[model samples]
Target: MVELAGEILNLPIPPHDEVLPYSESCTDKSVHDLNADNVVLCRAGDDNQLGIILEIQREKDKRKRFSWPA
Candidate 1:
């Protein structure tokens, strides 16, 4: 798993300034509580404007391919 994780980490990383600070993993438990790998949020200060969730796959999983779109 380390190799797989390392491979992912080797990818180009974007600067924090380019992305809003609101972007983070899904951790809220009150509402829908699904631990998302990473979530990109477009926001201005405290206001959350939009979100684009990205799920990581270390290996091939047929279910993930279909579920990721949801």
Candidate 2:
């Protein structure tokens, strides 16, 4: 997020420690062990903080790609 905050958004990165929940899931019960940079943003020790999902994807070369993600 330091990269995102500083490079992309040009904003200050929060000093608070980040908590990356292991296998954070929603209604679909999906997993990210093999896919996605599906991030949930939140400050530490705040259970009431509803995180927003930030899905980061890299563009694939269309010439070599066979399938696309949904």
Candidate 3:
């Protein structure tokens, strides 16, 4: 796992009309601050969702090799 400090990064989803209660272990700010093993936790409807970045794909795009929690 790699971390990027003081840089802009994107999450899996774009901003939405109604965003549920969500927590990303690695936030845009966290990425900018350079945190590792990023995980996002959120609620939608009646479900719990997570977006996890297992690895970084590219430094150029800061492309994240990520997955959803099960």
lDDT (10s digit) by residue, model 3, range 1-70: 1122212454354332332333334445335534444434344555554333443445644223343221
Residues 7-47 of candidate 2 have per-residue lDDT tens digits of 67565645445646544344333553433345546565664
Q: Roughly what TM-score does model 3 have, to 2 decimal places?
A: 0.22
Per-residue lDDT tens digits for candidate 1, residues 1-70, read 3234336667433222234434444434466556566656555566555455556789998878786453
Candidate topping lDDT: 1
In candidate 3, which residue ranges exceed 4 Å CA deviation? 1-36, 57-70
- Determine which window of 10 residues in candidate 2 has minimal summed lDDT: 27-36
Ranking by lDDT: 1, 2, 3
lDDT of each: 0.52, 0.47, 0.37
Error of 1 at 47 (Å): 8.2
For model 1, the superposed segments whose C-alpha errors exceed 4 Å read 1-18, 21-32, 43-50
* Strongest candidate by TM-score: 1
Query: Which parts of model 2 are misplaced by more than 4 Å?
Result: 22-36, 47-53, 57-70
Total backbone collisions, model 2 = 0
After superposition on all CA atoms, how large is the RMSD of candidate 2? 6.3
